[model samples]
Structure formats: structure tokens, C-alpha cells
Target: MSSVRIILNFLSGFGVLANIFLLVFYTFIILCHRPKPTDMISCQLTFIHIVLLITGPDIWLWDIFESLNIDNDFKCKTTFYINRMMRSLSICITCLLGVFQAVTISPSSSLLNKFKYKLKKYMISAFLFIWSFNLPFTCHRIIYSGAFTNVSETKQMKATKFCSLFSMNHIIRALILTVATSRDVFLVGLMLATSAYMVIILFRHKRQHKHLHSLSHLKASPEKRATQTILLLVVFFVVMYWVDFIISFTAILLRMYDPVILSIQKFVMNVYPTITPLIQISSDNRIINMLKHMQSLCHHIFKWR
Candidate 1:
């Protein structure tokens, strides 16, 4: 189990480093030009990547417990708080990305289209709202475990009793678990539904294009490709989320404390944000073109343009 935890930590660390490079690359692209909706999503995902990159190192350090002495209780509390907040924020942002894509692909005549303009205007506000809504939970996390104490010297130290990530009381713990589970389920359902609707609409559009057989509609291909890209993202979300949820659920149910399971959970949770920038780069032509243009500019700049 220890060896397994070490391997998982290595993989998670690798993921964090990869995400950092991708985030910086995407940031360069965004700085060079105005970003589209997909680019905005990538920007938000980059923020998530940075958060994970910082916290992932702490988790890796936590896994190698025997090597170093973590002196401050505040460090533990801060790390715990940041990790939980970033995880929740990532989940919320991914859900927003799905809904945003759904809205982007929606037909002008569709009911969802009525709010399309509103969505565009208030997209940043929506992001802020979710972040604010999650603030209380993040703030509550700080009250949990603080500095580590040597339990061997102080045999009477009730570490688990005094310091908990969440309430240790059975009822409160159950309530917290229920709420978290339901929230995740709701977001997943919304993403799946929106993705499914987009798929159906795209299918119908393709059928129409097939029947028309008109060479004038070159734009149809791009639209179809965009829809496919979103579908792929939705699939990625569902699979990653389910895997993480299952592991977490099992640990919660069995009261298991295996470090290996914890490492796997962290890896799975961080995987989506780490891969998200790449997905945006692959799926959006605007970002790709912007990146190419930036490369051209960089070369000219170095040549003293």
C-alpha cells in the first residue's frame, strides 16, 4: 500500500506539472488575443490548474509522512482548506463549462436561447456567484485540524476528536455526506442532460445537411466539430467524476484510512482540471490560431521587431 501510494503521488505530481505548462501556454494565447467562450472556460480551468498544482505538492508531501516534520498547525489547516475549496471550485467550474457549451450550441429558436444574451452578459457574475456560494464551506474548513502533534509522546492526545475535516458526529457527518453527494449528482445530471440535448440537436442538424447536400454550407462542418468536441468533454467529465465518486463513497462507507485510496482520490479529482486546457486547445480553433499567431509574434520580437 505504501509503494502504491508513492506511485500515485508521482503520477499526480506529473499531472500537476503538465497542467502548469498547459496553463501558461493557454495564458499566453489569451493575452495575445480576445478569447471566445471556450477560451474563457480555459482561463477558468487554468486557475483551477494552478490551485491544484500548489495543493498537489502538499498532498504529495503529506503522503511521505515519515521524512519531514510539519511544524505548524496553521499549515495543516491552510492546506486542508485550500485543497477542499479548489476541488469544489473545479467541480463547479466544469459544470458551468458544460452549461455554457450547451447554451452556445443551442438554436436561436430554442427556449434556452432566450437567456443566451443574459448568459453572455452575466457569465462572470455566474462564476462569482458559485464561488461566493462555496465560500462558507471553505471558511468552515479552517476550523478543522491545525498543527500536528506527536501522538506517541502524548498518548492521551485525542487528535481525531479535536481536529476533524468535517464534523465527526455521526449525524452531522451523515448530513454533510448527503449534501455533498447530492450536489455532485445534480451537477453531473445537468451536464449529462445538456450534453445529450446538444448531441440530439447536432444529429438532427447533420441529418438536415445530408438531405440538402449543399456545398454552400461549409460552416456546418465547423459546427458539427464543435458539438463533437463538447460531447467528448462531457464524456470525460462523466467518467472522471464517476471514478472519483466511487472511490470516495467506498472510503466513506467503510471508514477506511488507506493512504493509497487517498492518493488515488486526489489523482482522480485533479485529473479533469489538468486535462481541461488541452481539451480546450484541441476543441477550439480560435485558441489554436491565436497560439500560432503568438508564436509568430514571439519569433518576430526576438528578431528585434
Candidate 2:
């Protein structure tokens, strides 16, 4: 395999494993304790990332499906559609996470304070709405994508090794692009606004902390840490997302898949998902505490032996 393929495979493997670990950890917490609203969101996001990685073209899911003697059109349509859906859900959930955190950290007198009471209710509603919203917008993928036959005379563009996107009429393509772009723009804009608000809130809180306590006495609260982690993830996501978007849009416009560019885009696309779980694992006190508890238990068992 080429170096690019090797790296992409490694990333897919790591992302899948990390996201699975996170999914199980979050599930354990939900079952063992009164789950926080953010816990549900994090769990859902982890699950989405796992789906995204598995269905991702770079992961060779299509090749496996082909080996299974699955119908070409069926394999291409299902894989691409699910991958697109999960990608859409990934952004929506991440944006929601940021907005949710911003509301969570709002001061008692802030306008967003009212949401604290109905956070869980709103979270569920948001999840449903996002799923409903993205499902239709990305349905175009199913219509336009099929197995790649690579006829030199055709307008089909290779989306993956086995799947290609057939050209649509200009008007239909424009409408789909507009709707998808609008959704992405709105979500990304909301993420940015929430992130900026979070930064300001953090700054104000830190200033107050300095006034009320000595530097040595100051310690970050769980909410603050969660907010910081979300902020980092959001910022990183926006960067990676736009880079992926630009490359994809360019490819679509130029009517060329350019293997090297596609490879780079895939790498960029996977970066956020790959790092997301690691960020949560490292920053989340609960995960850290759980690890410590397991370590202590192991030590006790070893000592007893």
C-alpha cells in the first residue's frame, strides 16, 4: 500500500477504536449514574463518528461489500448515503454540544439561564430535528451516486474506488448545493458564535476568580474544563471541516477526483473524529477518575496474589 493509504488506514483504525471506547464509557456512565445532558450528546457523537469511519471510503468498506457479492448500486448507495448522513450528524451534534455548553456555563442572570431547567428536553428535540433536517438534504447522495464503471465517455466521477457520482442537471445540482451549503453555513456559524461567547464567559470568570482567590488557590471547575474542551474541539472541527469542504467543492466543480487531493481530503476529514475521543478522555475528570479506580483495583488484586 502507498504511504497515504497506510496513514489513512491507521487513522480509521484509531478513530474507530477511540470512538468505540468513548461510546462504551459514556454508556457505562449513563447506566451507573444520573446521566448529564452532555453525556447523551457525547455518546451520540461518538457513535456517529464510529459510523462515519466505518463507512468512509478510505476504510475500504466498499471493497469488503464487493467481496460479499453485494449488488454494486446497493453497496455504493448505502455506503455513501450512510457516510453522508453521519457526516452531517457529526457537525450538527458538535454544534449542539457547543451551544449546550454555552448555555450550561451562563451566569444565573444571563438570558440563556432559562435553558438550564429544560436542557434535557431541548436536547432530545434538537437531536430529532437534526436527524430530520439532515436526512432529506443528503438524500441527493443516494440519487446521484452509484457503482463506478469508469466509462470514459460518461460524466460519472469516481467518489471512491468502486462508487462514482453521476452528473445531474444544472438546476437540480444548484438547488441541492444551495440547501446543503445553507445547512452547513448555519451550523458552522452557530458553532463559531457559541465558541466566541464561551471564550468571553471564560475570560470573565477567570477575571473574577483572580479577584476572589489567590493564584495558588484557583482551580478549574468541571464545567469550565468541559467548556474548554468543547471550544477546542469546535475550533479544530471548523478548521478541518472548511479545509475538507473547499477541497470537495473544488473537486465537484472541476469534475475531477484527483486521487492525491482526495487522499488529503480524507485525511483532513478524519482528523477531527480521530482526536475527539482522545481529547475527551484526556480532559474529562470522570474518565480519569474511572481509570484511577481501575488502576487501584488492579494493584490491590496483584498485591493480594
* Best model per TM-score: 2
lDDT of 2 by residue, 1-305 (tens): 78988899899999999999999999998998887779999999999999899888847686588689989899889988999999999999999899899999999999999988787677778888889988887888899999889648677988777789998999998898898889899989999999999999999988877767665548787878899999999999999999999999899777777888889888987899999999999999888998999999999999999
Total colliding residue pairs, candidate 1: 2
Worst-scoring 10-residue span by lDDT in model 1? 155-164
lDDT of 1 at 109: 88
Candidate 1 residues 213-292, lDDT tens each? Answer: 45776465665676677678777978998998788668666554245676677668767765665665676676578779
Listed per model in order, the count of residue pairs whose N, CA or C atoms clash below 3 Å is 2, 0
Mark the regions of model 2 whose C-alpha exceeds 4 Å error after superposition: 213-217
Candidate 2 overall Cα lDDT vs. reference? Answer: 0.89
Candidate 1 — what's its lDDT? 0.68
